[model samples]
Target: MTKFISICALVTSILLLTSGRPVKTYSELYRPQFHFSPEKNWMNDPDGLVYYEGEYHLFYQYNPKGNEWGYMHWGHAVSTDLVHWKNLPIAIYPDNNSTDKVKCTAWSGSAIVDKNNVTGLQEGSYKTLLAFYTSRGCGQRLAYSNDKGRTWKKYAGNPIIPEAPGEETRDPKVFWYKPGNHWVMVLYRMPGGDKAKEGISIYSSTDLAHWTFESHITGYYECPDLFTLPLDGDSAKMKWALLGGDGSYMLGDFDGKHFTPESGKKVLDYGQNFYAAQTWSNAPDGKRIQIAWMRESKYPGMPFTGQMSFPTELSLKSTPDGPRIFRTPVSEISSLYGKKMDKTDKNIIPGLKNYNLLKGIHNECVRITGVFDVKSSNMFGITVRKSRKEAGTEISYDVKKQLLTCIGSQMPLAPVNNKIKLDILVDRASIEIFANNGEKVITDNFTPAEQADDMELWTHGGELMVDSLEVHEIKSIWRE
Candidate 1:
């Protein structure tokens, strides 16, 4: 019997050796090097972003079944530095065991740390992490987590805010309104058809379980977020900003119950891809950091369906366009910078190619900063991710037209003193351009050949002076 068992084990080992190393899946070819994406499946609209105990928790709309949108669940990930992420289990999901499965999927909402056990859901010494979400067939529901969000329990008296007839409401963004001494919720509501009114409905709650509708602000669409920013970095001059899902915002003043607009509709991003933007709750140092879903960008044959824009630090600035929002990449991104190259004060004539400007730079991932004196040239800018034959994306400024054209998308620019400054971040498949110190931002995705690693600077029609240009190779966040 012992000899027969030994022979069977030997045969199983031989078959395992012949099966060829467990078929490695999850390709990295077109995957983002820094952006957070699930290992496989669909993700969109960053939801429930909160900071707690030195960690940033990000919960996003996820379809765990496939690469397409369906059966929404809250996919979880945590980051200490916002550059590297550690994915956790699905934080919330539909109750599949229930007899009625269709009404069980969990939808978008916000999370808060119940430090004072306000909801009375605390178990033992763990501080309750309460999440408010929209459940199908139910308007709004409350869930609590005591094990640091590893598990969750839906409130027994759910559908806390019952669904109203003739109203299609979802996407509730809740926050702690300290002055009001209660929790505030900014919910999106669309009332029925043709004559339907679409806008934000404000509600207030005290214990994170019960809610009372306070007021409603119309003239906007879905995914409402309300926050305040200090104008020109002055706390005394602070103003409130109410944002919609489509990147349109209104400057206003919030008295914890109603929002009074000081300005009309204005756009935050003029790009095609940004959508469903959300800001982190309880950010450290009173920072207003935001991120948006980069929609409809081609990911080719990859397993994921969408990507998140680089996290940006938002500030209200007094520009010629009045109190406009300014966005810059988060400071934590600088930790990925590597070897650098600099070119200063060079005369670039028409039809001149500055090969040495990118002489030893052969990286697809880089951060390039350029300051150009646009006095002499009709058109001048840099081309990046080029092949040997110079096939790449061009970023140019037209002095005569007063425009900045990036791959055919033209943006009217009123340069201050005829000097244009650009900060471009190049990832494997996307480029984020910040012009005039984040006054204008354009994000676009491109597909380049595998060998397209060259770069060049060119001028058209006349001469131009390159005040300064610096390029720094960026390391992949996954390398750590």
Candidate 2:
């Protein structure tokens, strides 16, 4: 009997060795250096972002089986400083065991700390943390955590708001409305024939369970977010901003139940790859910090598929074009800076190639800031991820057109005081550009060939002046 047991164990070990699953190293080619990405499989749409107990929790839409989009789950991670992240177990999973076998997948939503015990579910010293998410095809649901988000349980009274009549609704963004001393939920409801009615439906809740329909804001689509920001940093003057799934926004006023628009619609980001941005519910010091999923980025021959953009602080500033929102990278990003380089007052003549301004600078992960004197050039810009065998990607400015172009996408950016400032963060597979103090931004993704990690500055039609330039190589957050 002992010999037979040993033979069976050997057979099982050999079968496992022959299986085709390989261990992940987190150092695969094109893996993000500083951005947040899953250890394996797929991730998208940052969900359930809230701050509690000195920890920032980030829950996201995830697929656990493969690097493609199916079998949705709520993946979890936490960070103390927002620069370093630790992945936790799956927070919520699909309800596949139901008798109907509807395969209800957990979709995007928000999380908040029930500090006041409004739900009356607090079982221990820790206040209940409520997670409101959509059970795709089944309507919205509620989940609760009492042990500081380490574990969660779906409420027995799920499908809190059952499927609406003839409309597909999802992505619930819930927040506390202090003016009315209640909670507000902004939900996305798809249009059914009458496009005018296809918008966000606002509802108020007093106990995080029972909801009362309030009003609907038309013309806004999925993943709606409504927040109040002080115009120009003046607490006395506050305005509400409503954002859509595609990063388009409008400034308005929210009077508890309804939002009144005060400005025309505006694009928050002119990036093809940025989508479903969500801000933290309880950020410190009343600051609005946001993160987005860099969508549609291809990571060929790797174990992971998606990444989140670097966290940015959102502020409302008075611009020539009414009250516009500006996004600047959080101060914690400096924690990754290393190996600095600087240059100033450099002349870049037209038709120049391999200019000495960028000599000996070759890195895939770095933060670059440059203030350029437009001078007389018809075009001036920077090229990155370049090598002898590739033209790489170009981030150029067209002087006459007053436009900034990155990769294949473009945004109209007027020069501020006849000068343009660009803050560029380049990783192995993505580029995020903040032009003119975040007045206009562009983000894109591309897979660079091996050894394609050099940079160059070029001009066309005339001379341009580099008032100042600084480059800092960024260290990987996974290096510990």
Candidate 3:
């Protein structure tokens, strides 16, 4: 029934879309580093995200029959572990009723598990899958699903928020916070600025009703996610961080009513294409785990996709300069090792790009550790699969400005340079990489124009060396 509805909705949309839209599919796009492209279709701007029961429910804008952005429906999937995902029935589709009756587009919004069933939202009630999202041509809408998210129903008092400040105002993330003594909403939108563009809006509500405009934490051009975390060592020392378009920001002492940034604004991951980030709710160990859409560096249009950095443990490190946001790959990547373990103790200058390890092995992984001499080439970069441009997979690590960038057919991100060991996760069309072991990472989901699977390292100029290099098999999150 869900599939039929989704198909019917899309078929009807083809007739309604305002011409000039391009259709795309998984076969047409590629990205490496962090992987989440639909196995056979189109997906973008993850929305209404929820970690329910024991499964991670991820919903995004999808077009069932084509690779275009219109005819939006809430496409969904569930994962026990972040990898290995199972496609669920489509979550939401256009009503196909009257043209004027609730023009639903399922724009960007988020979900929450009403554990207490407040608002008379019963656990077994379909309404339990409470969601807050935008419908594009329409205003903001509230929706619910009683049957564990298999189905949905828009709030009777739909367009619950009436109107947004402007036309581009969307991507709503709601959370239950005590600072203002009630639930607050953080929306990603541009604010009018002179000589500047801002992204991200903050709103407050005493009981999910009567919203009050607050402050603009800062401006960004993409989805903004705000959440509170306990200080590094003292559980009592809590801080709130905002994750979005240009990167992320950490604010000190959130009073629910407002928050002031204690330290400087921080860029969480220096990768070229990391954005539209989401976090795990009620983390398994109680700490926050974050994941992002590792995209190609090109502008909007459905293109091939890439892999994702493994789930990163987001933390804060206090530096004399200020509090530095820290990230590290989840510890489970170690399971990829088998018999192929190559150990080499090679020492060279900290700025050299080409290290001769001509004899490479297959079905293997490499781990390099170096203290980075941090010289002028701080734009220190590392590359893998440089079988001469128009071919193999290539990744670069820029130490100077702190960024992890990858380039390949279909991989498009702003360039990055710098230093450090490159943890390249390569398997088939997937490539997941974590530099600083996860603090900074890049994932590309692309099928190399041609497979030069043999791994080699190179750089533009100067010399950089390997402190230590170890090899192991890369475990596929898809393999059970």
Q: What is the TM-score of each candidate against the true structure?
A: 0.90, 0.93, 0.75
Best by TM-score: 2
Q: What is the lDDT of residue 140 in candidate 3?
A: 65
Highest lDDT: which candidate?
A: 2
Could you give candidate 1's per-residue lDDT for residues 26-138 as a string of tens digits? Answer: 33566777766778888888888888878888899888888887688899988898888888999987653433434667777888888899878899787888888887656
Candidate 2 all-Cα RMSD: 6.9
- In model 3, the Cα lDDT at residue 84 comes to 58
Q: Write the per-residue lDDT of candidate 2 for residues 1-480, one digit (tens) a residue.
A: 999999999999998987766634667788898899999898999999999999999999998888988778899999998989999999988764532223588989999999899988899999888999988788899999989999999888888888766777889999999989999999988656366788898999998899998998788778889998998899999989999998899898898799889988999999899999999998999999999999997988878889999999999999987888999889999999989999999888875665548768989898999999899999988899889899978889999999999878999999989999999999988999998899888878888887888888888888899999999999998886
Worst 10 residues of 1 by lDDT: 21-30
> Where does candidate 1 clash, by residue pair?
none
Model 3 ranges off by over 4 Å: 1-34, 95-103, 123-127, 164-167, 190-198, 206-210, 297-309, 334-344, 348-355, 363-382, 386-421, 427-433, 442-447, 458-465, 475-480
Model 3, residue 46: C-alpha shift (Å) = 2.0
Task: Give per-residue lDDT, candidate 1, residue 3.
Answer: 100
Which regions of candidate 2 are displaced past 4 Å? 1-24, 96-102, 191-196, 351-354
